[model samples]
Target: MNGMSRIVKKVTQLLVSIIFMYGVYIVTHGHLTPGGGFAGGAIIVGAFALIILAYGSDALKLHKEEAGSSASESLSILMVLILAVIGFFVGGMVFFNNYLPTGVVGELISAGTVPLYNIFIGMEVAAALLTIFIALVIFKEESK
Candidate 1:
């Protein structure tokens, strides 16, 4: 990478990290705070997008190639679906049900399905983002 690209890349990485951490903070405290699963998931991937823009196509080589990333992203989606189904079965009623007790507000373990959904969504978003980044980056490589 060029030197200016490297500096810009580092700054982007830093910003992305900060954004991801903020996402987590909002998600984890979603019950007491404003954000939740969807917000966190979207914001987390927002960070990934910055990474892609900053470092160019080669930045996410830490993960496998696009096909593997595709599989991983699919797996995370399937997992979320499976978990929701399992929750329904276990709850003996609604899908994505909060089977667990909704404890006091502001506690880590408070909102039941809220936290669970947040976690599943966060993971799914992260993996799917990686898949997307890998696909886009790999395309740039092939075009050369």
Candidate 2:
């Protein structure tokens, strides 16, 4: 049983790592293309979920029981709010105004606020998923 579990863990971990990298790529290229924060972030968590399923709770540890995740979630929300407030002062009272420069078309710093917004959304999604995982893990443990 132990050997079987170890093998399964390794396979699932490899798959999760691959999908996580792919999600990062997609989020980075969000504004330039279609897939944005919500999609890419969800993909990342989906990969992580697969890993958690195959492995155990120990593999998902980040330090102090989901500390990084909670912090990251707050940071992302803060950033989004800050940007919106900046928009109020800079880009008039419009909906998600393109405050920053649009830059070139296919560049890293293009798409004005789109990329930034996508990044925050991605962070939030990733953190939220981690929180959910932690909650579920605790709930199951308590039930056991």
Candidate 3:
């Protein structure tokens, strides 16, 4: 009653998972590919936005999602900071010094700590974006 047509809702439901997976793939293979945390996170948030647009904010539980996304953003940033500090300590006070071993040239696990950074950054970006979207939705509703 609060959203689009049934066909739109069904299509959104089907595409959301695929979009999320593609985003994850982009983030994971960022070192090897062009897409990275920021791009992938934006892609993931597109799925969230699509769901809200197709099914309404209530269907997505905006408040709960906002809280969860905020928490995830915080946790991910903290983790990134911790990783940077650890890198600094382990690499003779050099910040973000890739201390982990680089396996192969074109392999999945070749980049070592870079992949971890990408993952954490992806989480942070995605959560931040979702939180922003939720806040915008709530603000729009309140203003009306």
Candidate 4:
């Protein structure tokens, strides 16, 4: 899809970076902050959706991105599962146990497994949302 007016496209380009950065920040700081993987991932996906709106579906070539998103989602889910399994085996604990060291308070890496889980969840959520958006766009285009 062709892009919108030059002004809208330029504005979207500038805002997209800022939005993406905010999402990363939210995901990374989830353990210390109020927002976590889900919120941050949604924000990131929202930024992508904004781009799609500004520059139409065809311009983004979402088919390629859809595959990447699917892969990312699968990998993230696998990593989460692996982390849980490892935690169980190492400590003879239940799944999703926190086996790693808890660092200093108010620090970025303080929460041990929580932060890692948040990161993986963020990736999974972002990829899933992107895939959904791409599918919706494709369906819409096809129906038209």
The number of the candidate with the highest TM-score is 3
- TM-scores of all models? 0.73, 0.84, 0.96, 0.94
**How do all the candidates rank in terms of lDDT, highest first?**
3, 4, 2, 1
- Candidate 2: which pairs clash? none
Q: How far does residue 61 in candidate 3 sit from its true spot (Å)?
A: 1.6
For candidate 3, report its TM-score: 0.96
Candidate 4 accuracy as lDDT: 0.91
lDDT of 2 by residue, 9-114 (tens): 7787567778999999889899878898999988888886776677666666634658878888999999998888888888678756788877888888887888
Query: Model 2 residue 25 lDDT?
Result: 88
TM-score of decoy 1: 0.73
Select the stronger candidate by TM-score from 1 and 2: 2
The Cα RMSD of model 2 versus the native structure comes to 2.4
> Model 2's lDDT to the true fold?
0.81
The pairs that clash in candidate 4 are 1-58, 1-59
Question: Over the stretch 1-144, how does candidate 4's per-residue lDDT look in tens digits?
Answer: 377888999999789999999999999999887999999999999998998899987667778888999999999999999999999988766888889999999987787799999999999999999999899988988998
| lDDT for each candidate structure | 0.71, 0.81, 0.92, 0.91
- Candidate 3 residue 134 Cα shift, in angstroms, is 0.7
Once fitted onto the true fold, the runs of candidate 1 whose alpha carbons sit more than 4 angstroms away are: 1-7, 62-68
